[model samples]
Target: MKKSVFLACLVCFVSVLQAQNFPILGKVVDSTSGQALSKASVFCQNTTFGTITNNEGLFYMNLPNGGYDLVISYTGYEKKLLRISNTQPQKDTLLFVLAPQDNSMAEVAVVASNEVADGWNKYGKFFSDNFIGTTPNAAHCTILNPEALRFFYTKKRNRLRVTAKEDITIINNALGYSIRYQLDSFSYDYNTKISQFTGYPLFEEMDTTEDVKKTWVSNRAKTYLGSRLHFMRSMYDSIITDEGFTVEKMNDDPKSTKGSNIENLYDSSFYFVDSSGVSVGWDGRYRIGYRKVLPDKKFLQEFRLPANASVQVTLLDIADGFVIEQNGYFYEQYDVINSGYWAWKKLAELLPYNYEYE
Candidate 1:
């Protein structure tokens, strides 16, 4: 099997209020026939905001003012994604034009490869470990629609690829959320021990008992603290130190592990905050250290580090920099590569973009 693909995605902006909620209208239509596509799924990626198009192909959603990737999907059609920066009330209806999917080409390109008939049984654990994650929260997570998955292995490349026939359902009992994931692609390289997956996931808070809800609240708060999401939000609010995070510039040499303390995270040289948002164009790698929470035991063991490891640290490489909004959303997301602890925090630990710690 010869299979490969890649993707990049999100954005940010803010004003007086971090993000003001406003109504947005949109329509979806077939590009070839110019006909309205009814019942099409329209959503803002990584957020709970979503709606289905009506008979006339119209839909509306009230999204907080910020940057988002508007996702449009319908059966047997090529999915469309639009980067939207909604800072003001939209007066005009947004439009989405999608083309029919080439199932034949996609099949020949991806499916016709050396597919494993018992893929789920063979690679199910591997896939789930990498996709849903291996965090403590992930232990209680279940892939509700495992049957939708199709796995392929390319012997030549020592790579495994997984795709889904439809949205994959995931129930995160630990976080008390149900996730509908539109899986575009998931690939893993055995040689590099690298796994990458791309998709638009819509999160919905699950109904539960009051006791469970309280437990979920506590869990979410613990997960959010010292997280990359927390760091980004602190950066936007110009409260890095207040949030108990420290920034350091990594040594120039790739082999060197030493770094220098970044006394001023909001220094004009690498960062700035304004009414619009925060702009950070850090030239080199940054080491973010958070002592508010200790490193996960699994992370400590996985890295073969001492049990005394205190700080939860992450390494970041920014390509040409990126901008962040008050909601902790960032843009040129592809340019920001995460390593270390942050890389280990996958979907199971992810919170909705609209998540508010307070």
Candidate 2:
């Protein structure tokens, strides 16, 4: 998914409030040898649910009721993601097979010849701003392993691409968490001025004092309000108005802000709800405006917008439609793309699927 694109089965919205326990008993193995891969990392992307395989390549995790991209990773092997949900038919156990990293394929795809020798130095800040974000919380976040990242520039296309050899460790001091991100794909298009970074992130809570925890809670609360997760949860519970969100339809012109109000978000033509997942979309581009709070001044300053900007607005378009789950986890997620605000809140402001939402 690009910035104005997900088309994102690399979703960012996460978590559940009151939910049931769903168990995932899993095993990871080398696809070629059929040998168990011990110590393999098993995690639900964007959530606190994660663990490592035992000597037998077996791992177990209990998830709060919702959707998740279950990520499995081992060094020297390719990463795997299984889109899962609690509402689907329950399975007592699951198996994952990972192939060895194909360096030949990597070379062909990454175009070794076009590699930027001084990539990190040249594109570090740019990648950080676009992927990790430029928000206040982002300032406290740090990528610990720039060495694992590779960069490529396609001058003809005026695009930048970045990939990683291993899971990148990111320390988020502002939110009191350490993030392990398995970047799948990240590309930025100069002409469109859009960037997309798709990755599976596993979050681990940092050891900190109660004072710091309190600050984290406050920061998390601030981050959650008016967020994509908030919006999806609101739609799932049919509380769009109560949550202080306003939806306006935008015309075909991406630049045009003109549109009409959507009195019902669950209109039968554009949406359908069920126990599995909720189908959500609109005819064209739609503007989601958050009225409960003012736009973060830092965001305005980062984007160099007027100081008078008030509402937090997100412009999005869904190709056909996508299925959104209870915790805001959606699939065929890449079908949806957001431009303005939500895309601006990247990895730093992200929270997990099991976050305690008070």
Candidate 3:
């Protein structure tokens, strides 16, 4: 059987906005021997905030007051993820014990093929487009190690599956961050034209000058707005209109005889939260439309979608109500499936879990 290990280290700190900045302290060591593992990469997933473990296998990072999915990675060991909550009180130095990877698991090949090389050669561009996204910032993102990637195509399903032999390093020059991603699963269905990848990423801020820092700050804010995170926050706050979102719920129940009139089905009565009060945990579908249209020249040229067009999107299989904490941390109870405009936004548009509006 394939063996995978998981460990978590949660550290909550108040942000500068709250008048105090706290440091998250932790140590990484071997599970069996309790030996320190130095040079381990530690960071909040998707955010450009992280630091490496020192010689003592210790690390300290200052994170803003919010919830984050912290990731710790090292060579020859299984990656670990910790969900840190800002609401929790700061604790003593957290200890993470990592188990060694079983060598036998590496020897077993899930997909045997020489087609791996040919696949990357044939579908490299398509993979990059869907994975890194077509956003303006995507142009600055480069996959540093593409050779470690392996691919397999399923004819019946018309889907592509990809895996990596090791961690994939991506340099986001536009965002001034280096992302080290350990890909667990990846697939793209040709029939649906939808792609998805599950992985753990550790983001490291790139060394930059003061001027470039300003650019990143501006760019990050731009990317944050109109994002899924922003939408969720707006929904939780009951301020959809203020956030430029026109959310209308759709009846997905096949048994419900709501008639064939699509326009009538889009009535505001079906809104996620109406006079019935906010839906605590809705397990249904909804149409999320954004009025903010992208007018950036780079976006227009890259996507080639009509100029100044409204962004209309649909989300399916949402199993729960949009729940958000005071610190802008969204719980992952809703397994939302994004389609249309939002579907195109990928890692390139992803903000850190701890990201908060200024």
Candidate 4:
């Protein structure tokens, strides 16, 4: 907790497809009891495609051809993450066994009086700023159940840890969706200025009129541009420059001295790129700078940052190669470290993985 621990969870999985369909079937059961777990949430992480298990613990989903980070969660049980691939034909049903949380390991006693209340009052804004984001769209996002969150602050380590006692409901007016998120782990290290969270989210679209639907369509497209999904697609296609992005390598050595000259560090002279001139897979850290200036009046009014800002992102090593679907839906191990302008854009600006530009 004292170290620079950043667990940023900003991506949602949902993809809109035209025709290709891959059906996925799975079941959830208790690991120790071997009993079927009904009402357990099953979802493809980062996408709006998900469902709850039936009484028989069975669930099914039809997804477009691609890879997926499949997640399953149930109350009082450990969350399960599975890599799924619909790119190839599958003949077997998938199964997941969730273990009950070990009470001893999961318990955290609050020593201070009204610590939960005080911690929320003190760090709720910080959690919201980092979790929901500070973008114009984030303004439309409202967490429906803040009480489900329990916060613990360790002053000695300057770290704040958050855990969800229940699924947190969030309504996103900007994207026209309501999400139920099962947060497994969350931590913010003030010393390192990094925040991270892991959860499984199930999204339900709001019912709306044709006019509102059209508006959402346009809005989703706007949010998708220059997003993490778009950036990964550009990298896969080797069109970074065409997409108005520049890449630079940074000295991320933990032993390196911290420098004070921010502007000098961002100078174009230090720009870097892979000599192969192609993205082989999801592995590397780079400073990504976007040149496109957001023209949204609302964004301009709410956020204050220079027109150009850079974000640091690391594509964690994956056993299998990263997958980018035909529609720019990305499936891989990665995290975005927002800085400058991008840091201000939060949940309000989020689009589901299945979102498509018409």
Per-candidate TM vs. native? 0.92, 0.89, 0.75, 0.74
Most accurate candidate by lDDT: 1
lDDT of 4 by residue, 1-358 (tens): 4232322221111223433667888889999989999999889866789889999999999887555778888888888988765555576678899999877644445444134566667777888888887766777889988888888877788888888888888888887888888787788899998787777677778999999888877777778777766776676565777887655544456344332222332233432333222223422344555666444454454555343434322222233334455445554444334443455565566666666656
> Which pairs, if any, clash in model 2?
6-334, 7-334, 7-335, 8-333, 8-334, 9-333, 9-334, 15-353
What residue runs in model 4 are displaced by over 4 Å at the alpha carbon?
1-19, 108-114, 237-239, 248-285, 292-343
Q: Give the TM-score of candidate 3.
A: 0.75
Clashing pairs in 1: none
- The deviation in Å at residue 131 for candidate 4 is 1.1
Q: What are the candidates' C-alpha RMSDs? A: 10.2, 9.6, 10.0, 12.0
Tell me the whole-model lDDT of each prediction, alpha carbons only: 0.87, 0.85, 0.71, 0.67
Indicate whether candidate 3 or candidate 4 has the larger TM-score.
3
**1-358, model 2: which lDDT tens digit per residue?**
2654653323432223224657789889999999999999888889888889999999988777889988888888878888888888877778899999877876686664477989999999999998999999999999999999988899999999999877899999988899988888899999998898888888999988899999988888888899988888888788998999999988888777798889778788878887887877554688899999999998898789999988999988878777878888777777788888998899888988677666
Candidate 1 regions exceeding 4 Å error are: 1-19, 88-91
> Can you give the lDDT of residue 91 in candidate 4?
61
Tell me how far the alpha carbon of residue 79 in candidate 3 is from the true structure, in angstroms, after superposition: 1.5
